[model samples]
Target chain A: MARKAGSDGSKTAEAIRAAGLRLIFEHGYEGMSLRDLAQIVGIQPGSLYNHITTKQALLFDFLVEHMTRLTEALDAALAGIESPLARLDTFIEFHLRYHLTRRMEVFVNNSELRSLEPQNRAVVTGLRRDYERRLEQILAEGTRSGALNVPDVTIATFAIIAQLTGVVGWYDPKGRLGEDEIIAIHRQLVVGGLLPIP
Target chain B: MARKAGSDGSKTAEAIRAAGLRLIFEHGYEGMSLRDLAQIVGIQPGSLYNHITTKQALLFDFLVEHMTRLTEALDAALAGIESPLARLDTFIEFHLRYHLTRRMEVFVNNSELRSLEPQNRAVVTGLRRDYERRLEQILAEGTRSGALNVPDVTIATFAIIAQLTGVVGWYDPKGRLGEDEIIAIHRQLVVGGLLPIP
Candidate 1:
């Protein structure tokens, strides 16, 4: 019975996180209420506390978890890539593919930073910086190796990430272009941008 | 006395719009209340109706006003630029400069589309497409002249706009790079990306 209860508790916690993401996505963090969240999750308002401490904590958790998984997945994708250019290509494709399917999470993550408390904001910002540093390092490596001609690694890092991530804003699964086609086109833009004028 | 009343009414309406922008920027559309808006504007709740009909109307007004101004400004900036390359460069620079100074407006415009009613969203989306078509035409012109090698005009349009508009997110007037310098770096990334490989 104790084991069953433990499993049920974990399940409820997972449900809370999922529902919180949807609520925060539909309504901004400030717009969503605990009562609304509880109702959506089919739990009593009081039982919500059993799963999550507070709304702020739930948001902080969502952001931290998203950033953490993003960086980890990126690392996995880039594991075997040796050349700087190849690594850069992998990074672009990885970012696009990862973000394409997680539109709601990305939307909430981008829009809700204002609602996070200062300390929580700092933690999430640090995680973001860590993720950005991964790309910056790749760009820096390419610049040093003479394989690429990035005017400034820092600027290129931001520009490339922004360009790639923009796909999430407009990508449609039912659209004419397939995911692979979209990735290929963006890879051309980014990789083509970085390559030395031949 | 009637003339004075008209002037005061216009001033109050302007004040209401300004306060509404800030409120929507700080709190999402659903999160902001008419009472809060009236409080910030130092008017009674009843007086808000004198300036704006409904919260929805106020948000619609803000979006329409923003999109209108953005496209008009783009048109003005691109005027007299004959060459497709120059026009594209001007578009990038103008988008960055225009968005950088209006961070709050841009943030609300991008993030609050979700809060818009479907009809209002369609209207805003149409305006956005009109703005995007400006770049698409430029890309197509360059492609036709063989001066630029855009893999796909539509994809390039989205990618370049996203790359440029992203500056608003992280731009710091006090940062090491001046606005011109930042613009130049992105110009290199964008224009260089489109130039045929030598």
Candidate 2:
């Protein structure tokens, strides 16, 4: 609510959120302290409250922003796509890349999410569901249009996501295989199996 | 190490470890105390100390025993299977059942293993790695035998595991689908995708 320093406030908030995210990922939410975040941000602990009401608030913000980015990105990826097969490919590729670029942040959303209080958890979980819905829609469209063969769209959506998101656990920037290479293999596994038999 | 009760210390140790597993699964290790575990087994906390030195040690024991069960189950599932393709299906089914039975315990292993001390973490992680190596073995066998088709066995192994293991998050015993149906779907996803096209 403070919203001080115009653009400076915006920049500082992002910086603080990044630091908080790292601490939370390394040490569970209960383990991270506001003082640790403020010290990392090089600001008075009181000044931190100006940007976020509490540490939990910052966590919620990270989750919301993370989910929002995913929605917008997926929407952008699927824009004006007509072919069901193409839509499915875009869905897998977008999900994989979104996770790769936002590894730590996305991992937190996927793993530490249950730690949030009920109210905050609902908001975060709702947003994640929204993202999952996109995949469900793609699968539904693909099946209806005969572009794919899947038994259950609901199960397929979770399977695809869990398969793609595993990248965060093992994907290393220094690794020999690039992100695109990994994404390519993922696309092959999903689309190759899901695409209708010729 | 704790032994049995009733003149046999080994049995007593095993009972304590079993009680500890159920308690820790219901409540995260951090949330459960030695006292809670002892009470569940109808013993005093000091009695627990005679069996296991500390809560941390108890956690390590549960983890070791649980992981061993997982590995042995998976390994047995693949036994005497000559075809890498059939072996892969057995492997996936094993995971589906394992997650369903020990749902909470699996959740904790994936989520709370990082909370363990360095030494404990190493041992638990090694057990997990042994399970992971089984995944790699399936992929390697299939590729070497020219039975299954995939871009890279490495990515395929990780992708398949993530998709299969992710079931613990959403699977409900009261759900419409039965265990056999769910396992069938996993077989389709893994076998359908990996086996060479007809």
Candidate 3:
């Protein structure tokens, strides 16, 4: 269990989390040692428990917080959009922007899924399923409205999400394409894929 | 460097590679130890030298073999298809079918790239880039022939590949969707995504 970061411990807790994310990102969860984490956090090994209880707890905290924030932010983004098509468009844009700068988070989430304890894994998986279900709902609604040309809403939902999330793998802000251009390109691909065939 | 497996050593070498793959897939390349690998393969730790010199070499071999087979299989699959649209369809089917049953390969290839040594990483990345370029070539040719409406050939190629490769994450043989139906759903998504607006 994570001790809630109170006023004095908040900064230290945040710093610890950041370092944990970096270590786990570079080294697999099993490869990252608590001693290394404590050193990186500028804390004595024994004092590390002032924030996170165990390494597993730290990982669980990172994953749960990541998913929780992601889900909430997405909900907030889709709040006022009524039309399924509009929501779908918002989804593509929102998902891309959210993940564009969070490469470490994306890598850890995808790669270290095997490292999470079973109970923690279930919690994270549930949150992930919630996120997927959000997209599934949008696709289902879009299909119901005859505004989307999905042959199978579930498959399309997974395909589109996978396509969008993959941008984190190779996208570079310093490289050829700007964010808008990239987003526009994906918008066309995703929307075009979903639009009814003429 | 990996020794050329002679007739007597070939079986042991193959077994080592198999165990190496499983260890890296389960524990990550960084997390897996050569001692543990030897134990799993039922060989003395010193005997590992008969097959591979170092853990790095084993990882390099795994990645290189995976990408080499992928690229060659893709080339073979696309060899006779003259039409770009037909080729694109074949590429999607080939990639999906090749990866669908090889979930461990897909997971390790994507997750363990960071664990490869710098020069080795470059070699694997180069092979992967060659593969990506093949798709880029298909998209470029398709766009040039007016058979596709891809806004950006490079972006579409990545997007489609990502979309198709994502199937391995959730696809199960006993699942409701069969191969043909799953293939059709993806073909519609990838082909429709590339097709010009009506």
Candidate 4:
């Protein structure tokens, strides 16, 4: 649904997206209802059609927007970082910091893949692969330059991404450890893991 | 509900649990319905009550059973292993292998915690803490012995477990890499991550 920028329609669309993310995060995608979503967004139940075509579309939008922003932000973070090792350090910090504050989006993204329709799933999966490739390229370049000892680039990519994203599961903004401290610990683990053993 | 050992009633109860796991896995806890569960189990809709008390109870049971089996298996795997490094290695291998086959249970366990009642959530959380503590203790021991250069036992433990458990997310039993190869790659990532830098 297209709407004029800054108009009430666009504002309502944004509100719907935000509420959809929260509902999908708390209840799995299959469990979120349009009625409840409309209620939460303070719209009549039938009026949700003005913003989203379907619940499936809402989920797809969330995932696509998330992956797109993630990759774009990562690119911005790594620009002009020439060396593979330095770029890798930057990637780790960027990923950890980005994911730390977006726990709900991350949770919904990971857990809702099964709920996506096949074609939509493919699009989201492709976006995810694109994201993964960013890390894999970093690891592969590091391996080639003799700056890192990643035995298998693909496995290392998945392993490192998983390890970094896992921070969201336990990270608390108010927790004892600050964000920098958490990132520092993970940097040591990930970068330290890939460094060739002397 | 109590039944005689090896009775048909017990067999039916087992079937109900298995079917419940698959249903809750495919559909989230809230999405799963008793009617569908009964149909899947080949019982009349009303007959589901004979075996399971409520959908919430069934979910609670699945989680409790999964956690109980997981901790027991971990204890068995770690038995007679003395060295902290060896125990950590054993843990990586054990966790990888155990989670590899029980993908559904792990998915439901990780994703459906919100659906669990507060008291049930507390029990499951405690079980999870106990399991995490097992690894934390191993890291602490290795750290104290100067064998492992873990800066923080708790953070290291969470990172390693997340890295290992992630195998289940992408593991294909018939995929190119065999189980041993997967375990070896992860062992390198995890153990290499913790060793004191030269």
Q: What is the TM-score of chain B alone in each candidate?
A: 0.96, 0.84, 0.95, 0.96
Per-candidate TM equals 0.97, 0.87, 0.96, 0.97
All models: lDDT?
A: 0.91, 0.81, 0.90, 0.91
User: What tens digits encode model 3's per-residue C-alpha lDDT throughout B1-198?
Assistant: 675658558888999999999998898887889999899889899999988999989988888999999999999999988888998989989988998899889999998888887898999999999999999998889889999988998888888888999998899999999988999999988888778777
Prediction 4 global C-alpha lDDT: 0.91
Model 1, stretches more than 4 Å misplaced?
A: A1-5, B1-5
lDDT of 2 by residue, A1-198 (tens): 775668888888888988999987776676678898999999999999889998778888888988898799899989999888888888878887777766678657766676688998998889988989988988898888888888788888888888888888788889979978987888878877686767
> Poorest 10 consecutive residues of model 3 chain A by lDDT?
A1-10
TM-score of 2: 0.87
Q: What is the interface RMSD of each candidate, in Å?
A: 0.9, 2.3, 0.8, 0.9
Residue-level error in angstroms, candidate 1, position A117:
0.3
Instruction: Report per-candidate DockQ.
Output: 0.75, 0.48, 0.76, 0.74
DockQ of 4: 0.74
User: What pairs collide in candidate 2?
Assistant: B3-B9, B3-B10, B3-B13, B4-B8, B4-B9, B4-B10, B4-B11, B4-B12, B5-B12
lDDT (10s digit) by residue, model 2, range B7-99: 556777888887877665544566567787788787877887788988787777778888999899888888898777777878888888888
What local lDDT score does residue A174 receive in model 3, on the 0 to 100 scale?
A: 100
What ranking of all candidate models by DockQ puts the best one first?
Answer: 3, 1, 4, 2
lDDT of 3 by residue, A1-198 (tens): 776658558888888899999999988898888899899888999989988899999999999999999999999999999999999999999999999899999999988888988999999999999999999999999989999989898899899989999999989989999889999999998888888876
Model 3 TM-score relative to the real fold: 0.96
In angstroms, what RMSD does candidate 4 have relative to the true structure? 2.9
Candidate 1 scores a C-alpha RMSD against the true structure in Å of 2.0
Listed for each candidate, the true contacts retained, as a fraction, are: 0.60, 0.43, 0.68, 0.60
Quality class of the docking in candidate 2, CAPRI style = acceptable
Model 2, residue A95: C-alpha shift (Å): 1.2
Error of 2 at A133 (Å): 1.0
